[model samples]
Target chain A: MEGEEQRDGSRGGEAVNGSDSPASLDGIEAILNYEFRDKRLLEEAFTDASYSPENCSSFERLEYVGDSVLNFLITREQYFSNPNLSPGSLTRLRAANVDTEKLARVAITHGFHRYLRHNKADLHQKIEEFGRSIEEYPLHSNGMIKAPKVLADIVESTIGAVFADSNSIDIVWKIFKELMEPLITLKTMKKHPMTELTEMCQKRNLKLEFRDRWQETKEIEVLIEKQLVGKGSYRKKLIAQNRAAKNALDNLDAFFPQFNQPCQPM
Target chain B: MEGEEQRDGSRGGEAVNGSDSPASLDGIEAILNYEFRDKRLLEEAFTDASYSPENCSSFERLEYVGDSVLNFLITREQYFSNPNLSPGSLTRLRAANVDTEKLARVAITHGFHRYLRHNKADLHQKIEEFGRSIEEYPLHSNGMIKAPKVLADIVESTIGAVFADSNSIDIVWKIFKELMEPLITLKTMKKHPMTELTEMCQKRNLKLEFRDRWQETKEIEVLIEKQLVGKGSYRKKLIAQNRAAKNALDNLDAFFPQFNQPCQPM
Candidate 1:
């Protein structure tokens, strides 16, 4: 047993004593046994950037690969899930989902944070400088940060590890799905101002313009072909424009549709 | 030889003629033998996205793994080379070096393009739609539009494959270094506008504002601050705003340090 411990410890640099290692690879082990299929991949997956280059492969590299895999998977899944959404809508959805906060959250939920080994002091100092809690740090906290370059590598490394251990997509997806379920709430996905505005404008064939009438209080004026519809100050112009556009769209949908078509046009 | 050909054809799910089989294996084997220590990784590296769900293993998944590895290699190489650059500058440098155009160029130079296999129709359709030429497309172009994605995947897969075949980073780096050498060109990496503007503004301690002013004529007046930057008429305010901002930023570098520095009193 001691010899076995020594081999596993040295196999990938840095073996955790009893307290640090998870008791049941129940969550991670299933992935190892079924998904990774290759032990090298499993070793790579659990690897954090802390490992010395001479002793072990760092998860940093795997995290990079996992990021794209996650992106492609999410894009494919979302596209299929929401067939009616335009490309722009899908893009926003992806941005919201794949951004650091969400990805870290997903990573954490999967017990991924436990496996990660990075510079703790650096992460803590960064959070302090940002006036955020240490818990909010993506590396330490909810794993939500805009660091695609860093976080993606960690994520990919995990995937690589999972594959190494178990070597099956089905097992990997089981863990991935659990982690992602909360973020993929139907209610959260529905509220996108840009998507709503674009859909409205596209249907009506009316150009939405938030014209800036600089003379009047540095306010933004909304004009639909020389006729003023609504106006607001500069700060609120984006919202106002969207509102004005939305209102105009709503009016068009209600009024114009009555005259043009007997039933609601597809 | 015939038996070997049959096994290769069955494993790869490709129709193979006995005569053509040896020639095919020669190149694949040469790359595989030299590059990877694990043959499974080599097989997975060559596996295309087209075969993903239909087969238990797809190159798409491996591509996912490979992309991160390539990114890490490139990023690490660049960061180590230029220690003085800020994170933002490093990011831009990385982007400039890793974009599809650059990756495709690197991929071709390394002869990695020759090992790729894809459906011709899908490849042609993507090229036409995106206006990418064959020369512009990286390997696995049929699956992903971005060249870096394909390039990163191929690079990673090749590494994985080589590791599978030979388990040697020395062998992999041999090919990787050759491909990455051209991307290290400092001349190709231009400073991003935002970075320059931020740096210029910081030196001057000047707050930048984007304002839209009106002219007496039919065209709208656009200004960075008070100066008349552009006259009436272009629909895209974004273009005009950026140009005005650029002009303001250009004149700033010379005068900016004088106002903010401790050497000169405020």
Candidate 2:
């Protein structure tokens, strides 16, 4: 589906027409001033497939690498960020953070949309304006569908660029954390296993216990109300134990919804 | 590690101080060329840590990524190069080809010894001959010991450089194949399981039969000397008894050392 004109000119600009645009991307850069170190990568990150070949190389390939890098970085960050979070919870959180829509939102918040160069032929190019366009173009058949993929691609490519430019993991984390600030709220961080289990136990007026004991082999065990619920050997480590406890807690609803309910003198 | 001496000047030309005979790196470029598509990467390959940061960056990191990329590219190439090869065999071949010492030897054959540069304080710097210089310096060390970890790291970096620069799987394989040419002889290729299995069956005058027959579902089974060895089924296809024998014949292990011996009724 092709159209002659759009209400907004998000894609078309002097830049697309091979003319210099007076609007410098300096403002966004200042806010995200981590210094990507690799200028080539930064340019590539903003580059869209719609741009002519001579203008720039698309961020598609960088995005591919970036997507994996982000998964790895975020997974690692989440694991170490809150030691109390369980593996399953971390996994779910990771999924939520890395899902396309979430990342697209992050990209948007970081002023990613302003830097994009869109197509003049299409009427509905801006991602935010998606009401009548959805009805008119029907994403599956719409030419604009490629835009999201490209935008997401740019997001990942920027990450790859950041990683390449700087060897420091801390610096990279700072950039990611800043971009994902809106999503990674204190509420999200506090909703770990410890909090979840505590809340669940409180709601039912059930007594909860977490006994941490170390064995001769330096193994850590987390017992709940005299039950041998979770154990972590030296090799398995604390992370494993935390994850086990979280998993065990998640299943409490189906198995033991009423913790205070007295058993019939069995 | 720093010492200086002045030499006598001749009538026409004379050696001055700091003129350490102008390193006779005659054929070093050729060796680097074999592994890298661009001569720049080759230059980087031979660039030891000795050069000041102003001169050039060492090949240490490139070599790290190169080694992994080389393995990945070669493993993929070998998989497709010989479609009949099993995963295990391909893995062994990959391992053998990518060993550090073996790659060092490849560097030697390619005349990499002539061009090696290292910091004077580096343990490898105390050398008299080019070949000995290579052994003493172990450029792959990245200013560390020639231990397993360092060696593995260097090998990977080199592979990564080639993969990134050349971006051609075929060229990468060619470099890898050349490096492994001495170790992987035509004779050795014949000893590969698939090849040996085929030959052994032929020598014993045994016919490999793969019977694909099943009442409930279509199945394909490999038989050496009419003895079933391995089985595969396409029950979902629901096209059983449809040339199961022919499919089995193509997948026969040509290099299997003990084909159908278990099935023979002693």
Candidate 3:
């Protein structure tokens, strides 16, 4: 395992080297319109462990800092913006904004994935597949899809790199806030499909059950009133359940023809 | 439920009127030596939902914001202090500092618990019990003890209060940096007992198992080579497991009298 590179990280196109070239790094700075005091931080932000040896891998650390920074930015922003919101609501809202899907979308939006340095060979295919998949649900799939975590990591790593270099949160937020387009505000915020489906079923007094077929078939079916409302398949059980919930929510009209108003698209 | 008060949150002494008084609030400011620009934010920081009606509860919201801020502060601090540390180690170290037990200890040390305004009737007894329990472990108990969450909440809420009032993380950190005594550094940080025990047992080729009897009697036992070496009882299964690990570690001499230098003090 140590002798072989993972080669499983992806770039946007078929471009190779997956290494941080100076020109690409400069282009990244140009796009963000923020110059790093230490260029090494920016390079580290885009670097992947598979591309380098064990001792010099820094993106994970940067991503760690970035995750906290991003969370803080969103939390602080949302707290003042929504004064009357409860902590429960605030938590859900923050999660929506900074969750893997949202940040991964940010990376794709800003072409951050193009700058990532990695050895993952199949990553290109995964990134493209994710890009195509997300077009179906513009805002968020609400856990219906399992995003490539690397996409989100790069966004956080960049945020971390900027925050570390400037040592100013205001600057970091100023740069990324605009980049994270169509921010999920309270108006745009939507409940997770599982939460929506559960509440909807409970209100209608329907016999709701998530039948687990994952072990045998990697599928989960949402049963409502003894009727198979929706089914989804995934390698992970939770994801399968979430997809099943989303499928059930989307197909609510099949169960209640008169009450055909499915969950509104955010 | 709406008609009656909770009367559950506690003050340090057996004081009545779980409502916030101006003098007590003033005392809080004096304790921190940092005045709030907006006194309402300070009030909100200490205010619990039970103290007021649903419309006016703000401490939870503040706590929400403060939590992210605290996380960001610690992550940033640790990132710089330990340049060579991996993200995995950094995560653990950050968790050690910001965990419920550590922050609760901070609250107890700084007397922040006294200013908490709530309706908890049994809180006084709980706080007193917690105060006495921590005497056994000076720095941290590492999940051996389950600290009252409200104590930790107040610390984060106050940290949030200061950050919100001053709008400067610098001031919040300056005030709280000293209050959070003996910050858990890489030098003092210890692994969770469950993790430690598993690793130690694995290295020594000891067939170790955590037998769960929590559903029956809230007990967990560590069985090594089919011998009951250590057992712990707690309301929470995870805590019981952790306690059992600690117990097993403590009784290493009993297990193996030959090589008996147990886990050292922090």
- Better candidate number, 1 or 2, judged by lDDT: 2
Report the C-alpha lDDT of model 3 over B121-200, residue by residue, as the tens digit: 78767777777778898899898787889889989999998988888899988888888878999889888889988898
The deviation in Å at residue B128 for candidate 2 is 50
Candidate 2 on B1-266: residue-level lDDT in tens? Answer: 01112101211122111233323332332333453346666556556666656667666646644644565455444544664454456666655566654565454444333345555553233222223434553222221122223334334445555655765445666765655456542235323233444465667767765454565445656577666655545433222222233334345555344554554543
Q: Per-prediction TM-score, please? A: 0.37, 0.35, 0.85
For each of the candidates, give the backbone clash count.
49, 31, 14
Judge candidate 2 at residue A168 and give its lDDT.
Answer: 42
Predict model 3's lDDT versus the native.
0.80
Number of the top lDDT candidate: 3
Candidate 2 deviant stretches above 4 angstroms: A1-28, A118-126, A130-149, A185-266, B1-218, B221-266
Each candidate: RMSD: 15.1, 19.1, 7.4
How good is the docking of model 1, by CAPRI class? incorrect
Q: Please report the TM-score between candidate 2 and the true structure.
A: 0.35
> Quick one: best DockQ, which candidate?
3
Quote the B-chain TM-score, candidate 1: 0.50
lDDT for residue A219 in candidate 3, whole number 0-100 = 93
TM match of model 3 to true structure? 0.85
lDDT of 1 by residue, A1-266 (tens): 13444334322232222234322233344422343345555555655556545576656444544554466456545645764564456666766676665654454334343444454445423322232332453232212123323433555567545533553434555666655665553346543333554555556555556676656665665554455545544234454444455455445544445434443456
Question: Of 1 and 3, which scores higher on DockQ?
Answer: 3
